[model samples]
Target: MELRRITYENVDAVTSMSVRDEQQNFVAPNVASLAEAYVCVDNGYAVKAFALYEGDEPVGFVMLGLGYMGWSAPPCAEGSYCIVRFMIDQRYQGRGLGKKGMEACLEYLREKPLGSADKVWLSYEPENTAARELYHKLGFIENGEMCGEETAAVRDL
Candidate 1:
């Protein structure tokens, strides 16, 4: 799988991607994420939104925040990167693409695409055991922090 920047040609496909019905409450929709990306850019913050692809098919979405320190409940230190939003479409959920996509995100962040950072942070609803498991397998340990109601976790770059 590969991460591709959202462009005019793929914007519709990206925005239309959806997670499973049961997971609707765990993540914001792609359109909302894109809107946040736009607002972040407008407000002078670094954000990268991408469409995850398997061959030519769009399978997931991820948005990254770089050096953002404006969280009302700061779960990460300044200069850290955050996986602000992530979701694999319902159609792609059981295909192991989530791990591949996350690996891609971490690879991208390790390059410091927006700026230098030594860690990557993410949060998930406490009840989302699937997410917590996946994140833990990917090396994210809960730091006993919260970003709003979500449990915060971090991993070294």
Candidate 2:
């Protein structure tokens, strides 16, 4: 699995990708996530949005925001980068792409030159067992924090 920048050429493909109906409440769609990335950028947070590709086919989306520099959104922990949005398309689920995609995102974030931070954070609905299990397998631990109704988890980078 590889991550490619979301560009005009692939924006539609990325935005059209959808998670399963059961996961709708747990994740924002790629279009909304891309919009959030723009809002975060306009608010001064460094941001990155990517299309997850398996070989040459787009299969998922990920958006990352660095720091709490946004004017309206709550800030991340000091200088941490947050995985603001992520989801693999329903068509691409159950093939281990989510794990590989997350690994790719984590690897990219680790080398990112935003503010220095020891951890990366993300939040998910508490009832989203799939997400909780996937994230746990990826080494993310719940920090007993809440982002609105979502449970927050962090991983040392």
Index of the highest-TM-score prediction: 1
Q: State each model's CA lDDT, in order.
A: 0.89, 0.84
Q: In model 2, which regions exceed 4 Å deviation?
A: 69-76
Q: Residue 48 lDDT in model 2?
A: 83
Residue lDDT tens for model 2, 40-73: 7887778888999999999989887777745333
Per-candidate clashes, comma-separated = 0, 0
Expressed as tens digits, the lDDT of each residue in 3-79 for candidate 1 is: 99899999999989987778999999999999989988888889889999989999999999876635464647567
Q: What is the C-alpha local distance difference test score of candidate 2? A: 0.84
- Candidate 2 lDDT score at position 106: 90
Q: Give the backbone clash total of model 2.
A: 0
- TM-score of each prediction: 0.96, 0.93
lDDT of model 2 at position 107: 89
